[model samples]
Target: MKRCFLWTLTLLVSVVLVVPTQAQEEKFIKRKVAIGRFTNETQYAKGLFYDKENDPMQKQAMDILSSKLAASGKFILLERDDLDVLMAEAGENMQKIGADYIILGSITEFGRKTEGQQKVFSSTKTQTVEAGVSIRLVEASTGLIIYSDEAKGFAETTTKQSLGLGGAAGFDATLSDKAISSALGQLVENIIDKCVDKPWRSYVLSIDDGTYIISGGASQGIAASDSFVVYAKGKTVTNPQTGIKIELPGKKIGTVTVLQTLGDTPETEISLCSYEGEPLDSNKLSNYYISDK
Candidate 1:
């Protein structure tokens, strides 16, 4: 009896380990993001040589944030540097390639200082740079700001010379990059959390030959045979005091199964899905949307 019980326990352990291995991994859907505008509002901008039209500090902050987001491999970064030109060129088509969220930022504080300690036979010089960054996340669908926060970064370097033999440090220009990178790093996780706080959403683009065409593709973590729930948007009511229109909860209407994907790039990618239940009204497509199960 003891031998049989021990064998059963061993089988249970084996099944427990194997079951986890057979489980499918959760998919990571990529979110589309754009940096709308980054401005320099720091005291350094008041300097005599500062240029309002072309500020290096503002560009630097954007670049740092962009690099961090790209490295995470969880977002499709879009360009908005020439937003006006892009709008004019794309016109109404801009809606197809629009970002899910827009980030507006400002460099609020920036400064550097150097300290030197002198002695009879030895001396030390230290350089420090600090940067403050503020950002706001705007929902592209509603043009409303959803999240806002500020972060600070600091970097410093020290050099010591004994009997004037050690190396001398100059302006330490790289300190600025390090400081800005640090500040943006502190905010990257929060930005990601806020951006993904809600479930991902997509909409039906068109119906072609009975196949439902929808936004997003394999590049956005969508795959063939994957199922998504279809929802009909709820009614909208305007607040009496605030005058802000609020949308009611949505209703689950049906489901869709991915048939295939099209397009070469994420910007133009589209998925072909087959509806599971009764056909939906094509003319009322504006009221329908797709979301994760």
Candidate 2:
């Protein structure tokens, strides 16, 4: 019986060690991001056959970046390409849902080259494609560019023929897609790091019977009993030299505790929070925001 008891105790200890506690779990808060514009500025693929509004190269780069961001599962990507249609369809509510940051990018450089080597009994041919992309992360609220970066990608394919018996090589159109995808792949991680550099933030949406309805919910990592600090919007000042407007530091006003969550999707999710500390002016809630810190 004593041996069985010891075995049971060991099993219990193992279970406890294997099961992770709630506090030990990793926490990730999703931020809303929008790709404002991605354009092909390169000379490649531009001719009488090129369509400015529907450039294939530009579309491919945007799709690659969008796919990368989506796969990370760290951001709620807003659709900016059809934003005008959405605004017209959704009306006023669409305006409330805004991206925290906007990404404007361009394919600055793109080119292809072919090389060949001839020998007595054998010959080889190579096709190479290279692409360069530049991106700027802009703060939506302040209309300021916070980060800018560039990345390059290269791809090549080689074919060999023995006495002209092997298959001949032609233009490898897929290389363009591969090169662009590689370049954007290098930039995706840096873009994520820049977006999450600061604390996750949300704003008050409304107040119903003293319960505060705030802008994020389960999809954004806001859970019941989660605490957040509310801050008043900082004062904005215009720089005389650059003629740029800058916002000063904001003051901490109060705190809020998440009571419950609402909505089915990240874009529509909202949190019900109970206010504490300093009194908030309901009419001026737009001037305030809540942060994890």
Candidate 3:
């Protein structure tokens, strides 16, 4: 009997490797994202691009970032340039075209430099072009700015000859664009690494005399005695320029732990819990979100 029980236990544990559950199937869902008007904060005028024939420098950077994001396959891309027009054409409401997150950016640097050495016997000329950008992600549901960063990129070319012409190195056609692309590439990588997935969360289903019932199970990755931070959301702010909304995450209301599980999982979530910090003051438990610590 002992041997039979041990064999059955081993088989059950091994089934975990072969049988896929809802938790494994939907641990992370790909999200939709939108890129709004990228701000131009550079000292150079938006109209003063190296190639005046091309669109504004800020527009070019926006297009580059949009293209990269579309190719990533991690997010469903939404068009910001003609959002209202598309909505009117499709006869859809804002809810149908809404994005989970919105991205905003600014061109912080776009300029060129020329420096050289003059000598009786030898002379050299060098030109350097640089571009920098600042980007931030806003949570659409809450209107909160989640992340922000600034990055710079550079491109340089040099010419050297004996008794070189004493002429300044003017702007090259592609130098500025290349530098902007470089900075944008890094920013895209960081966005992919950090913001691709939303954090896992569960809620409080009910509260007893002193115990609590959590709405998570083993299928959702909950384990016995696991610690979690309980948080309630705060006020939201809107961006006047792009109309993107952001919300503050607010402070931790308290902490809780999984004391035991009560039912079958994935469909019927049931986690019993005990307060690890001060207990709930009111019906705030209804609005609380719990995340693993």
Candidate 4:
């Protein structure tokens, strides 16, 4: 009886020493994103004499892409345009935008060509417009270019049996818009696919005793009992070709549990627990990150 009791106590101690693995969480994880100002590279300034200030082609494309990304339920759209104001007014403490990635876009091609003009006998005129954009999704913490893709779309409109009414037609003016929208659609899809394949990450905005504030809630498909692996983010490495910095993979420090999901605002404060190997250091919360387990 004494030997059996000792063996049972040993098994119990071993079980207590082992940390339980967290079950797999959400089926789909959402990442936070910020859209940056995009540049227009088309050759309209030197020759075409089109007004670019009021309705810039690059701004138009940016708006389209932003709208599409916002409509897609895959991302948490954060505002990057007001970064300067936020820093100046709220200071660095308010600098945490809860964004995981940032998007930079450029309009590489934006032009319209009108060919086969109406002649004495030939009353058919064809107008073709093409718009192309290159997009880069950068990991905000490391500035790594996680995904890069370029898509071009073309729109053609032909006016037949016209009596020199091409000038009054709307095809020339609207073709560019149509083409831009089409290209942006493809870019949005590319972003979604890449993001889906990647494991999502969240940040520890602040810590309150045993509770840690994070940036995911019901909107991101997170809920109570969800588990995460805590890590410390490392220095960002630069991509030599593109000169974009990418965050290096972090070292696992500890684990956290979702004690409760914050109200309807897509924010939550979770509870921290000792990691499997080394106990998590509270002081090294700087550059700390969280990934779903």
Candidate 5:
């Protein structure tokens, strides 16, 4: 009997481990994303300021920004022509691509140069260029501006040697390229860091009058009398280092009690007393989420 019981326990553990492995393999799935055409607003009254042949400096700047954004791994970039074809067919509707989110951006400005003081007796020369860009993310379904940011770049020449005869010399062009690349790379990182996804397993949508709606019902494994903390969707701000942005700290609107559930949607009423002072402002009550605890 002892031998039999030990074997049974061992078998149970083996089954448990094997079952979870199988389940996890089945659950792993990749999320699809699409990057839209990046608009070039860098041109001034004169046309096409960023073309390398016409304007080498601006061309280099545009290339740097585009490449950095592409390297972020946030979305599958769509070519300009392909995107245009899709837009023509779908009339600029993002849902047509079946993407979760879309990135829209414009290069507002770009420049590069160097400037500084020099003392040979008394002489100074400086060259500098400035660039700016704005980027934003929109939800494919609701077209909400979930995230946005602006970044600026300034580059200056950094060379003290000039080529003459067979003498060795270093060029400022290389430094200019590095600066432009670094600034654009940082900007892309910031945008991606700020716009990543935040998923909530449960939610409670409510109004100021103490009435509330709950999701994650019996079908979703939620039960009646289950308590959840309510939160309102708030503003999102960018973090400088990671280039990723996250939602601001939410106000705990109130606590809610699940009164009843119908199918997958649960209807519950909330009490505002749990929050500080009165309930949250009704005007700001756009959406809400539930906590796991």
Candidate 6:
């Protein structure tokens, strides 16, 4: 009897630890994303023109944008060519590739200029580059444009050109570099902010006792301690045109607590708790929760 009791205790402890571990693992998962080739939207600018000359400046700009997005740790970037291939393989079902979102952008403008200022005893010269870009985030399934924004900046050269005591004729390389760097940094930051701030929707799988099961996890940036409001079925009405049944409004069920995660699978679990409001219905549930970070 003593040996049996000890074995039972050990098994219980193992089960408890293993269950939570699996649950936590399911909470949040990184999303796979396909960033379509950035189009050059500026008039008169050819597609991929910047890359044609092997311009390091253009390459740097692309690198800055890509690196900033990667740092967010929220999305897996798909190469342009790979996206094409996937689209071909999946055909119309390409949207169902388990991707939560998609990003598209364009470089509208990139131009540099220099100017000079002269005084009786000194002269100053400045070189600046201005870059403009537009970005949009959309739902992979619905192609809904949830977020969009544009950013622009100017970079100045470092070295000042002075031709005379009262005249400056040269460019400042250092100042130009500084200005470019600052603008690039700001553009990248803006893009990251847009991607993470948008509102997204997720589905609820089930509710056992006080626990709730959600469809999103680490891939969707879901974390423990996050709370969500539940909705339940409400009234029903008849459709005037088709004489069909329709739902009126969904009642707010209760709130849920994220207690654990399983993995990046389509179904994940959460802890559900009661709320003062009414429970929401299936239709309402479809509209309420978002997966965005």
The model with the greatest TM-score is 1
Global fold similarity of model 5 (TM-score):
0.44
Q: Which candidate ranks first by lDDT, i.e. highest?
A: 2
Per-residue lDDT of model 3, residues 78-107, tens digit only: 666665454455342232335656788888
Query: What is the full ranking by TM-score, best candidate first?
Result: 1, 2, 4, 3, 6, 5
Give per-residue lDDT, candidate 1, residue 225. Answer: 90
After superposition of all CA atoms, the RMSD between model 5 and the true structure is 14.1
Candidate 6 overall lDDT versus native: 0.57
Q: lDDT value for candidate 1?
A: 0.83
Q: How far is candidate 6 from the true structure (C-alpha RMSD, Å)?
A: 12.5
Q: Give candidate 3 misplaced runs (Cα > 4 Å).
A: 1-28, 45-55, 82-97, 119-122, 162-170, 199-293
lDDT of each: 0.83, 0.84, 0.70, 0.70, 0.52, 0.57
Candidate 4 off by > 4 Å: 1-26, 45-55, 83-97, 117-122, 162-171, 232-248, 263-278
Sort by lDDT, best first: what order?
Answer: 2, 1, 4, 3, 6, 5
Output the worst ten-in-a-row residue range by lDDT, candidate 4. Answer: 267-276
Model 5 spans > 4 angstroms off = 1-31, 44-74, 88-92, 113-118, 121-126, 161-183, 199-293
Q: For candidate 3, list the clashing residue pairs, or say none.
A: 142-246, 142-247, 143-245, 143-246, 143-247, 144-246, 144-247
Q: What is the lDDT of residue 29 in candidate 2?
A: 79
lDDT of 5 by residue, 49-92 (tens): 54523455555655665566556544333334365466467653
Q: List the residue pairs that clash in candidate 4.
A: 143-245, 144-245, 144-246
- On the 0 to 100 scale, the lDDT of residue 249 in model 5 is 61
lDDT of 2 by residue, 114-228 (tens): 9999999999999999999999987666667888999999999999999779968887889999999999988899899988886777889888899999988886777999888
TM-score of each: 0.89, 0.85, 0.51, 0.70, 0.44, 0.48
Error of 3 at 263 (Å): 37
Residues 3-66 of candidate 6 have per-residue lDDT tens digits of: 9999999999999899978887653345556665456554433455555434444445556566
State the local distance difference test value for candidate 5. Answer: 0.52
Per-residue accuracy of model 1 over 209-263 as CA lDDT, tens digit each: 7899999898889999988989888897888998766768788988989999888
